[model samples]
Target: MQTVNLGILAHVDAGKTSLTERLLHSTGVIDQLGSVDAGTTQTDTGEIERRRGITIRSAVTSFALRDRQVNLLDTPGHSDFVAEVERALGVLDAAILVLSAVEGVQPHSRRIMRILRSLRLPTLIFVNKIDRVGARTDELVADVRRLLTPAVAPLGTVHAPGTSGAAFRLYDPRSGGDANRLAEALAEHDDRLLAALVDDLPPDPSHLDEALRAQATAGQVHPLLFGSALSGAGVAELLDSIAALLPTSPSAEPEPRARVFAVERDAAGERVAYLRGYGGQFRTRQRVVAYRREPDGRFTATRGRITRLDLVGAAVDQAGPPGRAHGPTALTAGHIARVTGLTGVRLGDQLGSPAGLDGRSYFPAPTLELVVRPRDPARTLALHAALLDIADADPFLRTRVAPDGGTSVLLYGEVQREVLTATLAEVYGIETECGPGRLVHVERPTGVGAALEIIGHGFFGTVGFRVEPGTGVDYRLDVELGSLPLSFHKAIEAATRAALDQGRHGWPVTDIRVTLTHSGYWSPITTAGHFRDLAPYVLMQALAEAGTRVFEPCRRFEAEVPTDRLGPVTSYLVRLGARIDGTDQIASGWRIGGLLPVRVEPEAQRRLPDLSSGEALWSSAPGGDRPMSGDPPSRPRTDGNPFDRTEYLRFLAQPRNRS
Candidate 1:
């Protein structure tokens, strides 16, 4: 059978999991339907997910749709877990972007669409929940066109929507306006269709169907389908559209390779990697090379043996501890399999070579950090280890353990913080107290500053660094790269970058130039640790004299609210430190555009409903940077206060701080 690695995406509470259940049941994958409210869904296997009635992790299940095997990846809908969605994006052949007919196009929906468009991923829009009380048809379609995209081909129209007996009817292309709509949409990209329409030739039904599939498969036009995943209204029609519109997985490649999109530890605590093979095969007990690229564009290759391998698919309960795979010795192209014994495997690792993989990120990492402490101080190490495990599964978290044993975590929003604390308690048996979230900022030097580390500092190495304002991280060696040894030179370079993680004001220092003016070490007693220890003290002191400015990430926003409510909305935005740039008179209201602090955007969105009497839509994009207003905020230092000489020496006295 053919394979379609399909991804279902949506904003939270949009019935995406319901849609997954409907698809599975209709295909005879299960005997009874699963309910999200009851926490009996097939994809939400974790205890917390079931209790909270939300998907916190991405889950996968396979079922037969017609003659094709659909590997459905059900991802988390919450914005805080968008990084999980980002990881799954690479393995998908086509995607169903779910939206609520009642809520219309939401901020997260728009964001997901923007990413899909950027990747040119073939997508189909499902306006679900047609039977819901406030579901809409025409007005919702208009919102999708204006906000999401203009190239949507409506597959059918709804009848008696928002009622239990709601029904959907596919368009009769030979009869009515559906033909005109499809032709017009395809005309922009299809010359033949454009010519036929221009010649006043309304093509036959088969011709229109052929044209629709071709355009949709190429990601030129999105096919729109309306349905209620709850009542199964229009779901069958939507399935037909999916099979008829979307493309299948790529043809096989002879070279042996697979890309790791997810990493999870099984019940036995063995690291298991979920990988999709692009070509060739990986068999049990076979050695494979994992190639991963760092943020700096350098690739690292590690080799490991696959002691165990299994194909990914569940027998009865698709949600039950995903990766409950069927024993399989080898995984070939177009197949997803879980393999164990790849000890050093990581998320996004390519098994083989990185030749054909794209290591570029579609989104930036979370820019907010919070210090978390274990309530029981004895469990601090355990909490840190648990956070490390979570970070392993979701690398975007960027968990850090301070030299003082303080733990900090990066997050996308407040929801993640709550979820994280609960997870640590329930899953990891660690109670925690989390500090307030702070925006991560960066610093750039205003002038030049230099410092030197001599033998008198009680270190075995002599190093000096001159710091100046520049673009990007520039490191030059005034002394020879091999003056002492290549190891010492590397230590100083790496330490310089690490030391810059926090500046004079506790923000990450970037966009600077640093030259190692001097370097020396005692013959054999002096190790790389000496230079590593010296590099930070010298660079940070230099940074202090240089004087740096802290800048926080800023959000560029645009909002639409009723004309009458514009005053209050404007005042509200201003209260949150927004700089209003312009306003234009739109059809239903005023379109306001401006920049707002990134941290305050969620609040603005939460308050928008009341401000505009529940008719306003707000959206923002992260861009640019603004000077942090008022007193500069300080982030929790993980370096044990290197600026103070006494603390620096005292911190190094501990065994854990030896590195």
Candidate 2:
């Protein structure tokens, strides 16, 4: 039996957790079903998730199938918790992207597809909530093809059109009628399958399965499964599709490249990594070597014990060996193990699989930043340490301790800000005061600029360089070495990275190119720290020559509202400084699509629901750069009470200039 690692992802409140509960129930992993509204669901055991009625983080569960083990990860569908989903995809063998049959395609739904496509992950779409009245699976299926994929094909009809609360029967085009439709669709992906249909030769099950998996992973033949999570109709067949078609964990990998998707502190005050093994065998209590940092900021290889390994099914078991793990396991794909006393293991740390490769892609940069300060100034150091720990546990949550003195915690949204506040007050027992959280943005050179040259008189050394827009966002860098050996070019890149980190606006510079268009390294007499000391000054001096402009956060948004509300919606958009791109009538209402600036608080995406009387649907492409209006909006800083007038003013004074 093969083992598979799969993830369930959808927009917020799309019944992912409900579907997860049903999947577990049908698999016999649980004696009874659990409900998210009741807060009794297994995967949503996190206190934060239960209290908020939204998945603040991700959870894993596993069960058996046909003697095979399948591990399932349920990820938060909200755009704010995207970091968690991204990490999950890094380790997943396949993904089941959920869509609401009643609600149909959404902004976040498209965003998730883009992300999965980037990773080249095999995908299956489940059009859920089919049991609800007035759900149109046909139109929804059409939208999926138009918006997300031309390759999406309906698996089989579950709920009859215009019907609700009816018993669902699985369809197979291999049989007859609707099955023939599915067979015809399947034939488009494979010539042999088409030949089988023409010659009256029935296609074998394995051939269909293999073709679907290959095409799906290769961005073809997106299979859609319709189901009702509330009533559990069509769930069994959905499970069958996942079991029969999804690739299993440890399948098609040369060696293990495990990534730490989530991290939590054990009762003992040490960190434990939630690891997903992609291509290698894993054993409990085994020692693994990883690149980590020491207290003095030195990078070195450290050894750590696995401590315990959990294979999720029914209840998590401490499996001693790979062979002992369950096959066709349920919703969880990775193992949870406790480790302690290792100096530098971090949240996104890539651990070795006995094959020696460790480095992997780093997590995306944070999009929101706020200064975290303890109410009692005495706990400042403690607060600093705690934030560092959080950052260590989640690479995306970057924290920087300014040399001039202040600690800023980076996040993605208000939800993360709230979680940090709760964690600090409840978990750490520290009453913390947080500064106003603000949007995180990046800057790019609009025009070419030259690096400045300064001749060293004593403490100062002569250096020259140039900064310009780079070819791509991934490589916006600053180069400052006057001349370097081919072997030292990497070191120069490292030095430029150190400098690019904190631009004039104190944010990472992106999409901007820098060349030591010319530069002079410090003489032998100067200390090695000379590069560190001179790099910033040289960068700052170059800033004067090249000039600066701010880039504001922009979003691509889709807003749905009632047809009658179009006029009022346009009025609201005008007030919010948004420009419209197009408008169309959707199943529920009118959808206005366009780009909007991030500073437009009470943002249209957040307001459309209320504006439409809870009838509007909204979502945005996570983040991008746009034109800044010279004055950024002023919002209240909520880390503390809203009455802190001084804090409000300080937040208002934050640079409107993007970094």
Candidate number of the best lDDT = 1
Model 1 scores a TM of 0.91
Tens-digit per-residue lDDT, 1-659, candidate 2: 56667889888877899999998999998889988888889888767678888886778788788857677889998767677886777778788899987878877788788777677777888888887777777788788876787767677775464456655566653564654566666778789889878987767666766777677666567678888887888888888877766665544366555556677776676666676655455566667776543222334566776665655443333665543444433122244333344446765566663333333332345667788778887888888888887776666777766432457877878878888888888778888767777787665556666555454643234445566666432322244332543333444345555555555555555666666544454555544344444444555456545655567777777777898888888789878977788999877778888877767845666777667888776666644567566753332222211123354234334563111
Q: Model-by-model lDDT, in order?
A: 0.84, 0.66
Clashes of 1: 1
TM-score top scorer: 1
**Alpha-carbon TM-score of each model against the true structure:** 0.91, 0.77
Native-structure RMSD, model 2: 7.6
- Residue 584, candidate 2: Cα error in Å is 6.2
- Candidate 1 achieves a global lDDT of 0.84
Query: How far does residue 46 in candidate 1 sit from its true spot (Å)?
Result: 0.7
lDDT of 1 by residue, 256-292 (tens): 8898887777778788898888898898899999998
